[model samples]
Target: MDIRPIRTDRLSDKIVNQMIQMMREGNLKSGDKLPNEGMLAEQFGVSRGILREALTQLQAQGYIRRKPKDGTYIQDDIQSMLMNDSVNELLKKTTYSDLLDFRETLELKMVEKVIERASDEEIEEIIEGLGVADNEKVQHDMDHYFHYKLAQASKNIFFMNFIDTYYDLITEIAVKSNRDQVRRNQIAEEHLAIAKAISARDKEAAKNAVLHHMKMVDKTVIGEEGK
Candidate 1:
């Protein structure tokens, strides 16, 4: 059998992963103080230096906070903003085609939730600012308004973050494509109609609007060269 010794240099990352696993298992929780370095090093079968390095990394990442007088405790708000930092990095490898696929597949959930759960007042907030979509001065600004606010109105923080994460690319495509004013006008009207459908709580209209919008978006910029 082939065998190799474990590399000590990677222990710090391993410690972080182990602790994160414990957190996920609920054995550790928000605002709970971590053990002293020596004890933690012993528990993880590592030296104190490795444990300290892991703790420092966690503190830097906003997963924990160190109090000079007290000790290190899990950050109180970690649950709400679970960014999944490593997982999100995979977005770096994503293509515009992949982005279009995400819109085509996942955004239906967003519309459905907004229709079922959002208040009339919350829905009104997004559509109100959309103004005349073809208005040359504010049209670009209004593009993000409808989608971003509607994501917020979905009442799902995870969905909101997902949309927020990819939204920059969405805007990038729009900015590049809308250099042609006619295309810009069409996009503005489409987004306005879609937002209004959601505001009216018309599920069929909202879905058709979203799919139609994506069809236009797919046909616009973002060629294979850009990917």
Candidate 2:
């Protein structure tokens, strides 16, 4: 009810963030209908076109569902919506090489941070995460869990959010590259090595481990593409 007027250069982004925050704070509940474009735009002191653009972005991000002749409603399963949308958007915009490069950059920094910041218990938790992929029934879910745990071990909220946001894309690439049993086993081994390096608080070793793992992933994905 306390919607403030927007005056920033990035009006649409600000609007989207404000709406998302409102939803998070329970001011807007699931199934609640958003005000019509004109009314809401007026309330925000923005042009209707800007409001529409923000609404479209929100819809794309799965925050709201727009129906024909009806209002936009909050999504019931916000987390799923976000994950699916994030992956879909990444898939639309990036190539395999791009994804790999971004992931390598993120993970290398993440491991270094973990070595510098993570507690003993957090390191143990990261090691425990590797157990997920050690099973005979190793799956993409396990890979996602392991990487997520590693990112969390970095003790940086920004790193955690970046990993969590693009996790589906990361897991998709892992699943594709891991179809071969040999590659799967190699990946599991790499995860364990990375976990151990982090546990030892060896920043250089951890960085090396991550870089090697990413190289293997890149090779696997590209080799598969060629085949």
Candidate 3:
């Protein structure tokens, strides 16, 4: 247990990163109890409050679980935590176009899986979800819900979590891009195209629809940024 001292700005974040690194390197294993807060604070050369903040973050992110009347322990599901953290960090650094590109990749793959794995009922559920956004008025929440249902139709846990993690960020970009009725209608129509293609079981068409939609999103977001 060679926990290094953290003497940097954002001390809590540094501590969190070091703990994650330790877990990755097998220096920390699942079910291993964390050293007492006082000892950890002393080892890291940080105040107890800072170390507590880092522990709080770790608990929130599912990297560790804190038990009342007990100690903090490493969570068993380390991979999911790592994936979530990685996705969040990547999104923070991404520009509009970068996010659009990453989204396009994930969405295209997701729809393909949906086409392969979704039940007829699941497909209909997706179409029904799209109907929520079918109105002439643009509802950001409805739009986000439709895409989230689309991700669910993929029947992949990882895809579902990935979408869940980024949904808010995606919605923010959409809010910036959807400046008027025309753009909103265009986005609605794009979702309709994707739903229709998937319902018809046309994988190629679904892929094309998603690609077109992503390009439109990219253009809209970039255009908004230029303003």
TM values, all candidates: 0.71, 0.60, 0.79
Q: Candidate 2: lDDT of 45?
A: 93
- What C-alpha lDDT do the candidate models reach, one value each? 0.75, 0.79, 0.81
lDDT of 1 by residue, 1-227 (tens): 78998767588898787777677667778889988877878888888888899999888878889999788898887664354564366665788788778866767788888999899888777777755444433555666666778788888877766776676655656566656678776776787777788888898898898999888878875552364
C-alpha lDDT of candidate 3 relative to the true structure: 0.81
Candidates sorted by TM-score, descending order? 3, 1, 2
Candidate 3 segments exceeding 4 Å error: 1-17, 35-57, 68-70, 132-138
- What digit string (tens of lDDT, one per residue) describes model 2 on residues 1-227? 99989875589998998988787677888788889889999999999999999999999877899998988889888755555555666655887788788888989889988888889998887776664343333656677778878778777766666666565555555566667777667777898999998888888988899999889878987876676
Best by lDDT: 3
Residue range with the least summed lDDT across 10 consecutive positions in model 3:
130-139
Return the top candidate by TM-score. Answer: 3
Superposed by TM-score, candidate 1 places the C-alpha of residue 67 at a distance from the truth, in angstroms, of 3.5
The weakest ten consecutive residues by lDDT in model 1 span 131-140
Better of 1 and 3 by TM-score: 3
Ranking by lDDT: 3, 2, 1
